[model samples]
Target chain A: MLDRMKQMQAALDRLPHLRRMGALFSETVLIKVDGQEFYLVFEKGRIAQLLEGPSKKTPYRFSFVTDEDAFEEFWTATPKPGFHDIFAMVKIGRAEIMGDILLLVKNLRFLKEVLALPRARREVVE
Target chain B: MTIEQITGRYLTVEVAGRAQRIYFEEAGQGRPVLCLHTAGSDTRQWRHILNDPAITAENRIIAFDMPWHGKSLPPEGFMQEEYLLSTKAYMETVLAVIGGLELNRPVLAGVSMGGRIALQLAVHHPESFAGFLAIEASDFQPAWYDIDWFHRPDAHGGEMGAALVSTNISPYAPDTERANTLWMFMQSGPGVFRGDLSFYTQDDSLVGQLHRIDTAKTPVHFIVGAYDFTCTPEDARRTAEQVEGATLSVMDEVGHFPMSEYPEAFRPFFVDGLARMPSAGAGAS
Candidate 1:
């Protein structure tokens, strides 16, 4: 799982459009995979830090909470309902988003593309 | 709930001065509804609606295959060439069917390419339809996704476009449903998919035309699937907001083909939209 997250981070780093869209985003986004947590600190549309574990020193502005299984399904090359997308999962009560609406909506596409990185990687591997 | 029995028939209709044999299906017996299919898809997309006992009990549900689509054969002398669907010809065909059938101000429900035409039909002939229900439609595609690669022949000289679309179906869809969707995609004739895209992505531009929509005359409702990347919920909402009295709803856990992708899951939203239509008959509304 950690390796997969790392791969996703690497994919996000290489997405050119994310870099352009990320210009509007600058915050620490938290992703809770089951009980574990990670922080993706964005700096000038780039993932400055993919910090593993929680930080008593730093705070996350937004967070997504989902189980490891749901997260895996979401990142799979092809996903089914209850896993196809963040919004889809939210509708089926599998995932939750906790954060400012303005921030999320402002960078919705960027965040969606970033989260979809693993799918792109999976496709390439297939 | 009991499933309604669906009956299909082929009617000879005059379209663009040509006598065309069109295939159509219907169920239930109430206010009439003319359902249209998505691009490269046939009446099968509305199987759920056509078979829903609740909808059928209260509404006359009808679905038809466009010329050059499904069981409908291409026009004479054009069978050897690629089937190209132009907006003008598409609309003319639809209008001809309505007139030939003498459907009285029936409610119009459509998806993708069908949805775009519903909007056009409403604008040009508002009094013709009681209400419009459009899914996966917008004024225009904001950007062309470069669909040329879809038509490129594979190693076996077969177009891979349909295969590409088959993959986009939500992974969570029922195995049988997914298989059916792939079957529909595979059944399409060569260049038919691209021909439909030409209208979906290019010829049909509803931009600056939303103002012409009179909700008082014909209420328009837009429903977009949550997982539809081609037409996002945000885009549908934005487009719906422009027209007065037009409502927008997002179907969750659904993708590009909501009704066919997950019929049971999609029926509630469909029913809800139908209920919102004032002209919908007593039991339906």
Candidate 2:
């Protein structure tokens, strides 16, 4: 699963527009799948590092926490309505969003595309 | 060189004593189908259906941008106050357009907030429109909006708005098509989409009033996509449960911005919905 997450960095680099859009964005995102925590550090619009966690020292700008089943379904090629998006999962009570909303909204385009990279194929809507 | 049968025109009308110059486009010549766009978006959402001969051959399609939306500039006051949409104002604008265009009992078709307004139109002006076709509309959705998320200074309205609504699109859509839908959000003015949400998520909630929709006087039909998480199929079902005699058809593999996200998938559902309309002329053309 982490290997797929690793692919997001290279994938985003291929799209110049998205890369340019988030050229200055650099932050760490916490992804809590079930009880486990994974920290992804992004630099210049790309994922520079992926760190697994049980530690408490590192800080995260935003967190996308979901259970195992929801995470698996969300990463599918074509997810069902409630499982299709982070917002959708949030709507259905399958996920929780915490931290600086402004940061997330500001970097949403770059972040959303990167998070959704685990899908089998990507046709960047734009 | 191809000349599509679409053309635009503007009309100045009085709403709440404010002179609003409404921009509208038209195509084909037959029974009128007044197309109302979703919240935040302009008449461009109807571009595909407006030019499709399958639709134009049978019905005259008319779409207009709401005041403070798209090309319809805000009335006076330059920039002194905030923009918020109310049910009364929305309905009045629609009625004003209907009156100005001299459209006699046209079928009222709206999506999202426009969809919610269909219930208002059916209840308030039962005798005015021939029928109601609501796409992705439901009675009410509680806590569906957060203004600060996109309307704040730190956040980019265009980027946030585009990315936020991007969740409403079906993943089955190609990157290019989904990008086009995102383009609409990217073009939205500051606080415009959030302001429109004021009506959809607040002011015009048809919670208990949906049952008042006079379907016998004018048929009310809802055609929703399966992938619209915001106004989900369940939401449409609950709305239909409230309104007596109102019909609903949930299409599979489609989402909120059906027309733009995947018009080919949306075309059949739209055609079938139109057929059920009272003004549906002489069967399918």
Candidate 3:
């Protein structure tokens, strides 16, 4: 899991378009995987820190929670229909997005692609 | 590249008591297959099937750009009102094009919105066509995404449509075809995608009406991609199970835009399904 998160960070660093899209973005997003929660704090477009949760002070702009199996399925090269996309998982009741949707909608493509970094191969990432 | 096998032409059809010029393209020389594209897109979706000699040799692949889409222009009256496609208007235009062309009971093949309309045709006008090919379609799939974003001034319509569509497609689609699908959607006209959705995402449904489709008289076949969560294979399976003589197949590594996003993978199904449809009856319902 740590390796994949590192891979995601590395890939995001290389993609210029994502950064540009979220140039005005600066907010923390709480991510819950199964029973574990992680604070993904972002300054502008770059992720500032990935703090393991149970922290009481970090206020997030939004939250993206996923079932462990759904997250695993989503990380696959070619995920199944309901598990292929974040929105797909949401529609099928496997994923949830809570809190203010303004930033989320504004950078929908960005957030979606960012969460999908683990699946995007090295060749496609560059 | 000097000469092309496909030919494009424009014909005048009267819809809503006004003369409308509609553009359509055709290839091959045998039985006619009327192709319909998804919302926010045009006839170019069928380009691959038309170019494939194997499918074209036995089928006359005909595709048309609905009014205000692709090469088809909107009627005169210059932009006083917003364009929103209703079921009645959609049905009228489809019938007008078919009647104006005087096609002898062509088999109808459509994807997405086209696929939904094909389901409508099967229920209400079964005798009009030989068979119905509803790809990535089912009885009803609600518009789960934000519809206002499609034409909102703050958002770029082209980019939004292309981006949303990009997510719906299978990752296995070839890069070129994926690029083509995005490009075609990006070129959509203003309010076009939203207007097209007016009919597709409406509160209406064909759930109970599907029983009216007599497959022996006019076959109804469904080919849904496994990656399409909107109109999942499970949805098509449920619909097919209820209708006698109806058939369905779930394809892996394919998605919403099967006919466009991955025509290579979609070819075998198109060809085999093409043979399943018989000739149409004398009159259209």
Candidate 4:
């Protein structure tokens, strides 16, 4: 999975417009699952770097994960009334949010928009 | 920076005469994945998965805010039926967007409402897609309405919506961070409320229509969170049973929003699923 993310970041780097505007711009984002955390940094809308350790630096962060069955239930169920009801009852208690909430929010849309872009076509490796 | 410039060239596509802002961030070079957001939530739900090493490395993902949600504006005469109608319209627009970008039959990945739209497209227009990933989406069941409405007054509407939005804001989140998630939900406006009500109240028996899906011709995988209250594991297992040869994976310790709640657990399932797609490289013929 990590390799795939690197390949994606490299592909995004090739897109001049996206790279120029720095769509994936952020100092770092720390995400924790269980007790572990992963730090991701974006340079010019491409994943510039990633670090895995006990701790990291970032202006914003959020963490949460669910077991197998609950994850599937979320996708299959009808759209719920609001986000909170969905997350609180469904999400596992393994989440933590820290740092600059505003900066994180400001970039939330952009971060999502970047991921929403189609994946790069692979060179047909026979 | 303004929202437009910050997100790159913002594409505005009119659906049902309503101008919806479609943000495109192109990456890699492959078939497109039309990403649909959950109700009340914009395309941001794809954040964790989109950046996952597996997805970016293999396939293209196109995510857009549904009508009446996110930066996208609602239709002029927004009605209950329009939600379903707009979903169809969105699918058409997505097809156009893919054609405009010169990609072939791409996979469709949707969560919650997005999953329903994907299912609708798959059953009605199977040829348009090569594969499907309906994460945490279940066949519409009437039993969902069985929740005690009186005891959970918020389940119906109004303050309930407010509480729903609040969950996205982590108390651990910085003040500004919480505010931004709240703002995005708020930007969705009353249309968000109506959309949720429509989904909650509608008689969507999509599960009964599982036979319409050509599982062999188009590989379909259903990923669900085990403890999801809305679309429980039993619901997913039941739906999978109906679809001949459909693949089902129940992630333990995860919830409805696995992409956000448990990206690592969900990442492998997506990567393996996409890798297994027969037409991963079959661009538009």
List the lowest-lDDT window of 10 residues for candidate 4 chain B: B145-154
Chain A TM-scores, candidates in order: 0.88, 0.87, 0.88, 0.49
DockQ of each: 0.07, 0.81, 0.42, 0.07
Candidate 1: docking tier: incorrect
Q: RMSD for each model, in Å, please?
A: 12.0, 2.9, 3.1, 15.8
Please provide, for model 1 over B173-242, each residue's C-alpha lDDT reduced to its tens digit, 9 standing for 90 to 100: 6657866766786677666777888788877467777878998878899999867766767768877887
Question: What's the chain B TM-score of candidate 1?
Answer: 0.91
User: Which window of 10 residues has the lowest lDDT sum in candidate 2 chain B?
Assistant: B276-285
What digit string (tens of lDDT, one per residue) describes model 2 on residues A60-82?
A: 99899898888778888888778
CA lDDT of each candidate?
Answer: 0.75, 0.84, 0.81, 0.55
From the highest lDDT down, the ranking of the candidates is 2, 3, 1, 4
> Can you give the lDDT of residue B186 in candidate 2?
86
Candidate 2 pairs with clashing backbones: A123-B175, A124-B175, A125-B175, A125-B179
- The digit string of per-residue lDDT tens for model 2 on B1-285 reads 998888999999999899999999999888899999888889988888998987898899999999888899888994997888899999999999999998888899999888888778887887778889989998887656576576877667877888888888988876677888888888888888888887777773567887777777788889888889879899999988888998999888888988888888889998888888876442222
The lDDT of model 2 is 0.84
User: What order do you get sorting by TM-score, best first?
Assistant: 2, 3, 1, 4
lDDT of 1 at A89: 70
The 10 consecutive residues of candidate 1 chain B with the worst lDDT sum are B154-163
Comparison by TM-score, 1 against 4, better one: 1
User: For each prediction, how big is the interface RMSD?
Assistant: 11.6, 1.2, 1.9, 12.7
